[model samples]
Target: MARKKTITKLQILNAAYEVVRTEGFGGFTARNIAKKMKCSTQPIYLEFKNMDDLKNELFEKIKNYLKQEVYSNEHTGDALLDACINYIQFADKEKVLFRALYIENHLGIEKMHKISLDFAMRLMEENEDTKNLSKEDKFELFTKIWIVAQGIASLISSGLLPMNEEDIESNLRDALSDMILGARYSK
Candidate 1:
């Protein structure tokens, strides 16, 4: 009978995240992951069907971690504006991780679809009183803010926009306020 490996799946995941966090998706190779683990790539291959399998697992983990790390109830706050700031701050603080988890297409678009929805829903629950909102209204508001904020974040990531410390702070505030106002009902 073949013996199971001693290395945990979590170790592989952590190594993968480190690769992505530091070097982006381009660095997420079996050799790189193996190097980070100081082990042969065979263990990783045995644990996962392939690199795609490992990457898929890492993708789910990234989503869950983002929810817990950046948008959990503790990160939740009393005001809509504060939540927006926190969202922006989370993006800034985890730029490389965010890029790996989000901006990169290695994990494919389906997973990103789920993550985007999860993020929007969290923002809705945190920033707005969902009990006061209709389902249609909730979807609209969430979609609106996410689309715009994601665009801004992408621009920031691409170096297309000014990302100076003060600029990021001020732009985040202004953008959050605009999104809030955009969510207001006129009728």
Candidate 2:
């Protein structure tokens, strides 16, 4: 008799991610994950206490993946603009996953928004031009940028816009400039 293969936690989590990537959170299920892994649901249950446990772990992994890949962009002299472009590019590339994460709120929109805000603040600190801004100002700028970036990302992800990189950068710059002006006036 052939021995059954042992599925590791990482293997199960990876398979789950693949399921979410292709089928979105709507399709995230132990059966689907097992199918992706070409295994039975027993392996998934063995690796995770339940679907919720697997889902939480997969959410963490997805966040890390987004931070390292989607949100992490090579600096183009302007760190904020680079981040915006990278975000839009991520939507373009991972349309379904992006929709799941941001559009469908499968991973909890509030948590994702907090993660995005934190990342934006980190980028703000890295930029010499805006590094000295007060915390409140930093937040204002981040919020403005996030609103615009998310809007563009949604449009691109939903097939509503065929946004070119240059156009995205231009829009980001405009939004940044407007936000700076508004912040200065309001202060």
Candidate 3:
């Protein structure tokens, strides 16, 4: 008798990640994941209670992946600015994932906003430029910079803009400077 092959939850999650990474949320189904893993859908069902459970886990995995692989590694010395650049670079590099999570709203707009706001607040606490600002000012600064970053990221991911690293950095820096100046003087 042949031995049975057992699939683990981690394996299913990884396959699901590949599915989402390639086909976006539209293809994020157990059947697609099973096909990607070269396994039967039975294994996926055995590993996960339902697609929603798997999807929730997958979103967490993606968040950690972004934090570890994309955001944390930026070396610009400016936490918030580095985050903006990282967001843009991630959009350029992971076009499918970027469109799925951000543009197509698979990550949920409110959740994305909360995540961005929390990350911006944390980064602002560490940034010399915005750290001392009032919470309202910090939010204003973050909102301005994030709008610019999102515009650039959206255009780049959609293939309408082909910008180099220098231009990206320059634009983000200019936006950051302008926002910071505006926040300071608007009082």
TM-score per candidate, chains pooled: 0.77, 0.92, 0.93
Candidate 1 steric clashes: 0
Best by TM-score: 3
What digit string (tens of lDDT, one per residue) describes model 1 on residues 53-107?
A: 9988987887777666655533224444444445556666677766765677667
Candidate 2 per-residue lDDT, tens place, 9-43, comes to 99988888998998999889887888888878998
Write model 3 residue lDDT over 1-187, tens digit each, in one string.
9656688899999999998899999999888999998878998887789999998898889877877787766657787888888989999999999999888998787766777788889988887777889998998887888789999999998999999989999888888988898887788
Q: Where in model 3 is the C-alpha error above 4 Å? A: 1-5
Cα RMSD for candidate 1? 3.2
Could you say which candidate leads in lDDT? 3
Q: How does each model score on lDDT?
A: 0.69, 0.85, 0.86
lDDT (0-100) at residue 124 of candidate 2? 80
Instruction: Put the candidates in TM-score order, highest first.
Output: 3, 2, 1
Task: Tell me each candidate's RMSD, in Å, in order.
Answer: 3.2, 2.1, 2.0
- Model 3: residue 63 alpha-carbon error in angstroms: 1.1
Stronger candidate by TM-score (1 vs 3): 3
